[model samples]
Target: MNWDDLRVFLSVGRLESLSAAARALRIDPATVGRRIARLEEETGTALFAKSPQGYALTEAGQRLMAHAAKGEAAFLAGAAEVAGQGGPGLSGQVRIGAPDGVANFLLPQVCASILDENPELELQIVALPRLFNLSRREADMVVTVSAPTAGRLLVQKISDYHLHLAATEGYLAQHPPIRALEDLGGHRMVGYIPDMIFDKELDYLEETGVSRVQLGSNSVSVQFHWVAGGAGLGILHDFSLPHHPGLRRVLPETIRLKRSFYLVRHEDDARLDRLNRLAALLSERLRAEITRQEGLS
Candidate 1:
């Protein structure tokens, strides 16, 4: 009946582990277990079923989750509004999950400026090579290569950026001349491992008619470095090209690849003014930064 119990329930439901919920709620595991039991007793129904893979929500719990999530969102919205009235800047945590290329080259400057302006804000960037599980709240929001097709989410096209076949100037000077796309075959290639390409958008080499990756890594940073170090030619983002002056686009007229980044967040988060403002700022700055950096490239 109390908000505190409901809060505990939501935490356990979201995290699916007593110890994990305890850590997030800053309580002990035993106390979380007791509160959950007390909540179930008050409602006269078992809300969770224990199994080998932590706690699983029961059918009753599933029914309760919808109402509980709405209540939690409402409480957060109220708290955010109240806090906003007393402050000049946003506060609390905002975690963003993004692929490594954007995380490494794009978000650093954008997030730094955001942090400078919003001194009270706590921002985190999780850079991985694969899709983030928003259902687990792995991040508050994400910058994705493609708009996700399914999920209760708000997706916005953030910006379009270009990639091109690139090689270090020194590598090009020393290796076989690349006059066209077919010329790429004579040069060693750097790219993602064929089987490890997580998204169709990331398959940049597919259209280049290149069949093999002599040096491969799932990470954009690794592949970037391999090319920057004059290891080989590979497809590289224009925004990232400015980071390495020696890296030159190869066959720009024939091998240009354009891709867009999308901003995604939980639809429920739309009610939180603080998050909405942050997301707006993120989109605006990222778009501008992409333009500025790509201009330099």
Candidate 2:
């Protein structure tokens, strides 16, 4: 019935869980339930069907969601227009969602700079196992290796990074020789979980004729740790490798896999000066880090 109720309804509808919606909105689950109950009562239809998995939207709920999305967009546009009267400097909190690797190894220095420049601005760094929905305002911005596919999002190619097969000197010494992809079949391989983004590493290696990789893991950091601890050969992003004495590039200059990092924000978010400034700062900082890491190898 009200904008706040519609906002809460949209959050619950998208996440399909009362608890998740509550957490995202920083409100209690009771409040979220009450708001939804009110909205449903006012509309004279069930907006959601409760299930063990989560809330399932009804047909009427689906119809309302389309209009809710447009209304939310207009509301955000109006808010940004009014905020812009204060000029271009950033204020308030900006939530940034990034994959774990980027959050851990890449964005720290950039975040520090942002804080230094705008002490009044708060930066919320959410380390997602995968990318979040920017269109739904789950995140104000995102940095990812995978390209953005959302129609209403703006994607910028920041820089390219290379992935390399790496192993500890100790492990390589004990394992069978890996002179070519064919030799990798007999050796154990540390890898990402089947459903994770880095499964491409395994697929690519298999396609290159190394069909028998011993799968081990899904976490990139864990895979790297295993490689450093002499567990097995693992494909690692070049930027993730620290100057550990035990770890070395397995094939050196012979094998390389490259992927680009993208900075993405919702197209509707373009008018928000705070979001745009944050995106620009992220792109500049990440580019420098990528260049520095590439130079190291």
**Highest-TM-score candidate:** 1
- Winning candidate number (lDDT): 1
Each model's lDDT comes to 0.91, 0.77
lDDT, residue 267, model 1: 82
lDDT of 1 by residue, 16-61 (tens): 9999999999999999999999999999999999887998889999
| Candidate 2 segments whose C-alpha is farther than 4 A from its true place | 26-28, 73-88, 195-204, 243-245
* Model 1, TM vs. native: 0.92
- Alpha-carbon RMSD, each predicted model: 2.0, 3.0
Q: In model 1, where is the ten-residue run with the lowest total lDDT? A: 81-90
Going through the candidates in order, what is the number of backbone clashes in each?
Answer: 0, 4
| TM-score, per-candidate, Cα-based | 0.92, 0.84
Clashing pairs in 1: none
Looking at model 2, residue 9 earns an lDDT score of 93
